[model samples]
Target: MEIYALFGTSGTGKSSSALELAYRMNIDAIIDDGILIYEGRKIAGTSAKYEKTKIQAVKRAIFHYEEHASEVKRILDQIQPSRILILGTSKRMIERIVEALQLSSPAEYIPIESIKPKQEIEAAQYVRQTMGKHVIPIPRVEVEKDFLQRLIASAQQIFSSKKEMIGETTVVHPPFTGGRIQIHPQVLRKIVLATCNDFAEVGQVLKTVFTFDDLPRLYVTLSLKLPYGRDIPTLMQDIQLALHKETSFCLNIAPASIDIQIAGLELITTE
Candidate 1:
């Protein structure tokens, strides 16, 4: 199989632009962040972005772990796409991935500079440095299963032409950065429970499940003791909006999905 490489520094929009590059080149599959992506879906291998530490993340990305390398190689052997694109931070990194995966050397190299503008690259860098956001070229829903929900965020870019629309490219942030502040899961849960209890409609928080992948969403099951004549649907909507707003304001992070299940509702008894 023929191989092509895309090389750039970390946080340089390499992952962000991966799909567009692959589409343009007529590439069948992509080797990115230790995952094999085919037809815009992750078919095999675990993402390095899911790793907690940056060192481990790097090792995972390059397929340094034998199982990781072997799994990807197995998939590669199965599909055997004619053309493949590999993304990495440098030529050496790409070489290492190719060697570890037992693939042929890249026949062509594309620099990130050639594809992305200076301002765009700077903007990506700013987010990575300040907000610690890393973009993965996969949908947020798919990422939610494997990553911490709090650190996850989704981004979509629309590509269209006069003839037809190319469609949206999804982005996800993984919790593998070294410099970013780490918020414990308990702290986030408390924030949710506290927010729910503060609302008048909510009687008690039965359970709060925090998804740390795909925009730090919360799956909340609540017990509501509503006063008589209150609109339940409106109250639920209000609670949802309130939780989303309060979470963003309090934690400086917005949740992607807030599913509130009403476990019980009681009418206030007038004396």
Candidate 2:
């Protein structure tokens, strides 16, 4: 069987992107989180998300349970899909899943970074880290058939599929890592100030403001000290890049927009 792998860090939107990738590649089936989803329906295997602890969840995700591996392998053998996409948190994890299922090595590996935009990946990680929400790519079916019969339709946030309609998707909080994470606003502000001061071109940061009604937005006013002929646009672009990268690193959330205004410029001799 031809196999393709999609890998990313936990909460980096791998599951959210799985159905689309599968549909785009014309894959016949998907193996994710220890479940066999075929033709927009789950065929066999237990989801690791339902595990009660982190260790148990890791075991389930890697198909550590003999019965779970056997169940999925049996169905895959019966269906004999020509092309399949396997989603995992990392290449090592995918390797483990492949080994446990006795499947051939993957012919291709697609990283989540290639599939999702930097901002989108950061947003997904923010939701997962702060609110404990996870995107599960499974179409809605009769509740009786669901492995977690307890989760009602009302509790899930579902999105309709594309025209090709690989499968519907819902946001869920996996039991193994479910909880709320709180980050102080002051911490976010400090991150911005520090990143700005790191630039040698910046003379002084006159003002900094952060708005957090929906997505975070940053407004920065600065005085710059540059050589007589320094390129202004390129310098500002560099600072913007640092702000996004640093803020995302510290808080797992990047501002939707950053507005930087130049208040003053002290041009020095290029000589």
Candidate 3:
């Protein structure tokens, strides 16, 4: 069985992408972010909670994972001779989860992040304001109409069709008022990591399809504008080392000679 984890940060499209990829790949089931989410089915202990305390939230989250992990493992054993598990988690969470699970094999790990929603909304709104005048309408629901009629019949609230122009109008949905922009920190991180995944994917294809010792050289290029952190290079080194130690096959894994330039540093956080 093979596990493919769809990892990303909050609202990073992990759930949506996981479902799509699982359908495309026809994987038996998906262990989404440590939760066993099967196709068109719901499992227990997978509830969305907006806890206030971070520590409490973390503890509750761990409990939920433990509750479902064994069941997921059992399901993997009996059905779907070949299984792919996709987990959505940060790098730190992934390390802890893998260690706790004692997984001997390489399980795909993806790191998700986001910058800030305010910045994204501001950018989107700016574009919309500069572009043109537009407004999106939200259709009134039938239930509201029915409730209005009932209220009129019972004399609870008076109903009348009154239309008086108070001021100028525009075309666009209120919810979509903030035009549209791509400036989420998490999105930025996703873009950066997507390049890494692309490289890994290409290497995977080459190793599988070619399956030869002397393979054609391939190069992967990636760019990121972030504060210069030693972690970036260290992370690259870790990935290369992991690949070298894990794979024992015909294909040789080596770092290509290319440019790994850091555009700019935004912030520097130490661990």
Candidate 4:
């Protein structure tokens, strides 16, 4: 089978990107943190996340146990998928998994930086370092089957609301990690307000609302001053992009939706 590898150092959001990357590339299965997932199903193998310690977790992730490797290998042999995506921290780690599973070398090597921007990756790493939460491309319910219910932190279905995007993702707290670091709504509001104030065109921020239900969704009610030659639509896009970029850089997140309400418009004056 042809293999594709998406690798980055720990906490760089490799797992966070896996599902969308797989969908984009049309990969048939995903092997992440020692779990074998095919067609949105956990076919075989246990997650290394279930381990109690980091050393043990590393061993499990690399399929150190003969049974772990054999079970996944046997299933692969039976199913014989044409293409598979492997998630790892490095090329060497991918090599170890391929050797463990008795599979050939990867036909493609995709680094995390190749797919993710530096700002986004740093934000993801910051989240990992601070919050200790990790993402798995598998669905929350399916992954939780091998995990205690308490370990399930949250989940988001992959990509867009568009129908043919068939994947679910789980955000988990591995047994080795500590507690979470939540960004309160007030903090988020301040950040949004600050971003708006930074723009010369914004006259006032009337109100701000930030929601974190399934994904981060932001709403801002504001009035703006019209610059000499700039249209409202272009300025709106600029505000949305700035908000998205600022949130991603500061909080390691991009909102699912950012709605900017223009309450009032006044023409700018140069005295």
Candidate 5:
């Protein structure tokens, strides 16, 4: 795959310019700073976060990536080598991008402001003028339908194997009143459904949806729908927030609060 890099400040509109270029040039993947930003997904493998002091969070992200690196590589290896990739990054990380892309010469450094529309008011016009439907930023649905089902099954097994609160079983506190305090399967379904609902709404807003297997590693997907009358960027921001929350879901099997695996999205199409 052809890998391209974009660099600028935090609010200099790096993403928009990259998306625009991606539309024009048919770029397949985007790297933002050290994070790989594709469609609705963003992944940071071995990248440091804003709060370096959050050691536990850092460890968690790294552990997951380390454990799954082979699986990720396996999936990535399936993609053709000549695919064009465009990445967005802060100007500070240009060196890293250079090394990663293995550029033989000075990399193409396009200033975000130069390519960005004169004002935020021009975003709609810019997006319409640039991106085509076929070239829209969206994840390839390869989450594998069975992944979530397997995750849920694993969660069920974990929960079932745990001890139930029966016969007024007490710890250091008051005794339980209910005879059967087992985790209900319905609760799992509800968690999954609620998470999916968030996914749907977020997908429509961001113009991206992610399959669950890509979860925790990369928040990936494509926005299939664009709002007609509402503010697009605002809607996108909201979806981004929801995406952050959904990606952090870790199921507590003892209480049977299974984290809903975000599989692929059900695209909203007029056809």
Candidate 6:
């Protein structure tokens, strides 16, 4: 298999530009942050961004765990793509991943500087430093299943020069980053309740449950009081949309599921 490497320092926009580079080179797969991606889907391996410490995250990225390394290697062996792209902070880091995965050394090394301007790289660095956001070259839906839901924010879709859809990228803020801010569960619940209450059709938020497992999800049971002539389905749809938008905006994380069960409905009296 032909191997290509993209190298840059940490937070230099390497991950941000990886998909575009792979598309331009016509590469079939990408190995980045311990995940194997093909056609913008994560096929194998867990992301280092899920680790709780920087040291552990680094180890994961280089495939230090035997099981993790074996999993990715097995997939690569089975599929056997013609060409693959590897991303890393340095040439040595790329070499480590190749060795751990038992893949051949990269034949071409592309520097991040060649693809991104200095100002862009600086801006990426600033966001990484301040907001603690990391880019994963996979769609948000795929990421929501694999990653901790609290860490995932939004999906970014990239298009080619001809306006063809290339791939989707996810922005995440892993807990391993130092000085990163945390959103309290109670605060998040309150935001959800408030958002639900904002809708004229919603009477009260009965109960809210937040699950923080492999994927974070929210379950809300609420009562809605519609106008005598209002459509129930339409009002419920509006509530769902409003709840999703407000909750995602406030938490900067996507919930794997937002289940709004209407417990009861009351009639609004005309004045």
Candidate 3 residue-wise lDDT, 1-271, digit = tens? 6655555444333443344355555665654433444543433233122233445445433434565556655655556536564454465554454444444343555433232233333333333443321211111121133223222111012112454211111132222223343334444334334445544222221111111122222232333333444466765555444433333121222222222333333443445
List lDDT for all candidates, in order: 0.79, 0.80, 0.37, 0.84, 0.36, 0.84
Model 6 — which ten-residue stretch has the worst lDDT? 146-155
Candidate 2 lDDT over residue span 172-250, tens digit each: 5667665788777677667877998898889988888876554567898999998887889998999999998997687
Q: Could you give me the TM-score of model 5 versus the true structure?
A: 0.32
User: Which candidate leads the pack in TM-score?
Assistant: 2
Runs with alpha carbons beyond 4 Å of true place in candidate 5: 33-75, 81-83, 86-92, 98-107, 121-271
Candidate 4 at 107: error in angstroms?
0.5
Q: TM-score of model 1 relative to the true fold? A: 0.62
Q: Which stretches of candidate 1 lie over 4 Å from their true place?
A: 157-170, 178-271
Listed in order, each prediction's TM-score against the native is 0.62, 0.73, 0.35, 0.66, 0.32, 0.64
Backbone collision tally, model 3: 21
Worst 10 residues of 4 by lDDT: 145-154
Worst 10 residues of 1 by lDDT: 163-172
Tell me the spans in candidate 3 whose CA falls farther than 4 Å from its real position.
48-54, 60-68, 101-104, 107-271
In candidate 5, residue 129 scores what lDDT?
27
Off by over 4 Å in 4: 151-153, 159-162, 179-271
Which one wins by TM-score: 4 or 6? Answer: 4
Which RMSD values do the candidates have, in order? 12.7, 5.2, 22.1, 5.7, 21.9, 12.9
Q: Please give the ranking of all candidate structures by lDDT, highest first, separated by commas.
A: 6, 4, 2, 1, 3, 5
lDDT tens per residue, model 6, 1-271: 9999999999888887988899989998999999999888899999998889999999999999999999999999999988999999999999999999999989999999999977577657656765688998888777755555655565568787888777888888888877655567789779887888678777888888876543456788888887698888777778778877887687655565677798998988777
**Candidate 4 lDDT (Cα, whole model)?**
0.84
